[model samples]
Target chain A: MIVLSSVSKWYPNGARPALIDVSVEIGAGEFVFLVGPSGSGKSTLLRLLLREERATSGQVVVAGRDVARIADRRVPQLRRIVGCVFQDFRLLPNRTVAANVAFALDVVGRPRHVVRSVVPEVLELVGLGEKADRYPDELSGGEQQRVAIARAFVGRPRVLLADEPTGNLDPATSIEIMSLLDAVHRAGTTVIMATHNASLVDAMRRRVLELGDGALIRDEADGRYDQTVPQPLSPSATLPPVVPPPLVMLPPAVPAPRGVPAPTALPARPAGQAPDAERSPWATPTRSGPVG
Target chain B: MGDTDAQWPGRLMRPGPLASLLWTGLRRNLAMTGAVIVTVTICLAMLGAGLLLRAQVHTIDGFLLDQIEVVVDLSDGITPAERSALEAEMRRDPLIAGVRYETKKQVYERFRRDFRGSPDVVAGVGPEDLPAALRLTLADPRASRDIAVTYTGLDGVEAVRDQRALLDPLYRFLDAFTVGAFTLAAVQALASFALIYTMIRISAHARRRETAIMKLVGASNATIRAPFVLESAVAGLAGGLLVAGVLVAAKVFLVDGKFARQTMFPLFGWAAVWESAVVVLAAGVLAAAVMASIALRRHLRV
Candidate 1:
């Protein structure tokens, strides 16, 4: 669990604060989307959670520890329980896929037997079991991200913070990644993903916490991406309802096998066509309508 | 997780993985590693050689100084009773270690033997021409000047010569050489430290990605730095061993073989060489480890 009370972060010599008096609480096992544009303090918030940076004012607590006050030496211990994933997939290019994953466990001083068992198991869970021996350069972008995901989840961290994980991937591959993350969330890990992908936010309809100009402007359950903008109820409205096509259909809560690669090549869709809700992988039919 | 944390220290105690990591780091930077080892070897070898040379000079200085004596020459017309009285007085003096009276015949024979290589010089000297004298060895060679002045111009004395005065130039030269050797060794030690620091910096830069990933994965600072420090330590160990070998070879081939065979002065023995070698070995390893640790602190923050 995480609690931030009126956290305000100011970078030295910066013209404005990065996060302005923002306070929000994220509970365990809840999949939350942190929606924001560029320079919206999403990455800063994630770094604060990881204790990579301290809050200039106010308390930031993660897993029952005040992150701002934790000693530098104890940062590693805090990191062990909080996993991070990045857009660039910061994998060691020279290392094999399995080695990259095992590194997470190895650094924490896990026994060899545990590393030997846990690495391959996590790789398999990310659907990269067959490419365990390949290097990052030898894998596709999607596969490399899968390896990064495997590494993040290898420790079974209590909270997973993803900073634009799908920023560099194609749309279909991004769907596969989202489905994988959804599976992880179903396994009872708290997932806080920051992204600018409007369609993914709209399609998933999870709890959305939006940031704008370093301020927490929206906190909505099952929210849409552009919910902050008031809807114009007139016939002269310029923008149509932006319903993207369902690119791939994945089995609910199951990791796809290696043999069946996610449908990465999207089929062209007619403009203004509303996607079928039944076909969207992220749609939860039992959830209530979007609440702001 | 708690169980794993309990076992974390025990896992580090296992040498297999840590050793492999150290080996991998060294292998990855083979050129730098070789440079470090070679630098340490040459630096420590020079230091050991300098120490041994200093020891040898000390031994020779002590030997030559022990042989210093004040020679009091007797006048040709001095009486037999006067010579007997002068020898008895010198024998009773505490300043003199020993006194030996030499007759003109014995002095002439010694002169002939000393100048046998130059026969013309020996032919010019005769038994009657050589001065009969009392050679007084001083308890302390440094007291040679005072004792010589005390006996100078005394009755039945022709001249008093302090051998220490004649050997002063040789001692000064030896002392200068010792200082020069030590200074050169100190410079080489600085060079070795700089080389090690540079090597660690380059290796840390080369493996930045690995270290950064380790930090991200919650590796402790010790765990992140162990391999780098250990690589330098291994190089130091190798270099120290090579220095010891070079020292032993220098002692056997240079000191005992060439110098011992060529000179009559007492030289330092194997025990002194081993002592210097051990000191050099320890200093090399400790310096390398310390420099590498410092460089890592600056270059590898994690």
Candidate 2:
């Protein structure tokens, strides 16, 4: 679980604060979409959760520990339980997919047998099992992101924070990457992804936390991309539907193995449930309570 | 997690991704690594040679000191009683190992025999022209100063000279050379350190992305730094070993073989050579490790 209570962050020598009194609570196994325009504090929030930056005047508690209060030596232990995926797909260009996946386990001192077994299993889960011998440059953009996701999930972190994982991918490839994240989420890993992709947020219909001017603007249980100005969900609006595999068919997403979120999808929304114009862009003040 | 933690030390020691990272880094930057090794080896060799030279010079200084003596020339007007008294005073002092008296006739005969090749000069010299002298061997060469001061203004003494006065300039020259060698070695060592620092800094900069990825994946600072540290230490150790080989080769070919006909102390004894080699190796590794660490702390965030 992650909790941010009135977190405000200001960079040194900066004219404006990056995040202003932002507070939110995200439960385990729930995939959260962090949507905002550039400089709107999307990345800053994720960085705070990762303990990359301490909150200026508030508490950031992750996995039951106050991140800012923890000693630096315990950072590795904290990070081990939190996986991060970046927009650039930061895989070692020189290493093969298998080695790249194995690196995550190796640094934490995993044995040869465990690394050997876990690497291929995770690779196969990400659909890169056959391409394990290929280098990062040799793979497609989608495939490289797969390798990254494989690396992040190989350690079986309780929380996965993805910052613009699809920023560099095309529409089709972005869909594929989103599906992979969805698959990882279904396996019970709490995923908090930051992106400018309005359509994916609209399509996923997951929990959406919107930020504007570094403050919490909206939070919805089953949110959509309409909070900001509406945009097309994808390049091809009328593209044919693709049925992703069920969660059982994918690898287990063990949500802490402590039974946090219910291991069941709330079901995908039926098409044409509500027209875009009929839904209010901003939450009604009466219904939109103050953030915790 | 428990299993991994328990086996961390063993896994760390074993060759894995870190070892491969070290190998790849070295191989890709072979020229830089080679430069570091060569520079460090030359520095260490210079330092070793400087130390050996100092040791040899000290041995020669000791030998020369052992042969030193004080010469006291007696006045022509001195009475036989005064001469006997001066000789007795010299013999009574504990600092004097032995004293020998040479009369005027005896001195003249000895000088004629020594200068027989120069017959004209020897023929011009008379028995009165040569003064009688007392040759005094010191029990301790360092006591020459006290003996010279005591006997200089004595009634029978015309002049008192210690042999050390003549050898002082040569000793001073050798001492200066030793200091110069060490200074040059220190400068070369600084150059070697600069090369190592630059090498590590460049490599760390080049690998910044990889290091960032490692950090994101929960790799500790030690984990990220281990490969770089090991790489430098390995290079330093290789350089140190090369220095040892060069010294041994020099000992075998130059000192023992080429200078075999001369009666001199060995340039550096085997025990001293090995001891110096060990010290050099340890210093090289330590210096490299420290340089790598400092560079990493400044350049690499992880």
Candidate 2 lDDT: 0.77
User: Candidate 2, TM-score vs. the true structure?
Assistant: 0.75
lDDT, residue A267, candidate 1: 27
Candidate 1 per-residue C-alpha lDDT over A1-292 given as tens digits, one digit per residue, 9 for 90 to 100:
7777778787654556677666767777788899879888898899899887799888899877999888887788778778888888888876799988987777667878888898989898999999999999999988998998899888788788999999999999999999988988887788999998888989998888777766665666677887745432121111123411111111122332322112222223244433222211123323422210
Candidate 1 chain A lowest-lDDT run of ten: A243-252
Which 10-residue span in candidate 2 chain B carries the lowest summed lDDT? B1-10
Residue A219 displacement in candidate 1 (angstroms): 2.8
Candidate 2 local lDDT, A1-292, one digit each (tens): 7777767787654456677766666777778898878787888898787777788788888877999997876677778778988887888888899989998888877778888898999999999989999999999999999999999999888899999999999999999999999999998888999988888988998877767657665566567865544321121111123522111221233452222121222123343322122111122333333211
Indicate the worst ten consecutive residues by lDDT in candidate 1 chain B: B1-10
My TM-score estimates for the predictions, one after another, are 0.75, 0.75
TM-score of chain A of each: 0.78, 0.78
Instruction: Write down the DockQ of candidate 1.
Output: 0.16
Backbone clash pairs in model 2 (N, Cα, C under 3 Å; residues 3+ apart or in different chains), count: 3
Interface RMSD of each: 10.2, 10.0
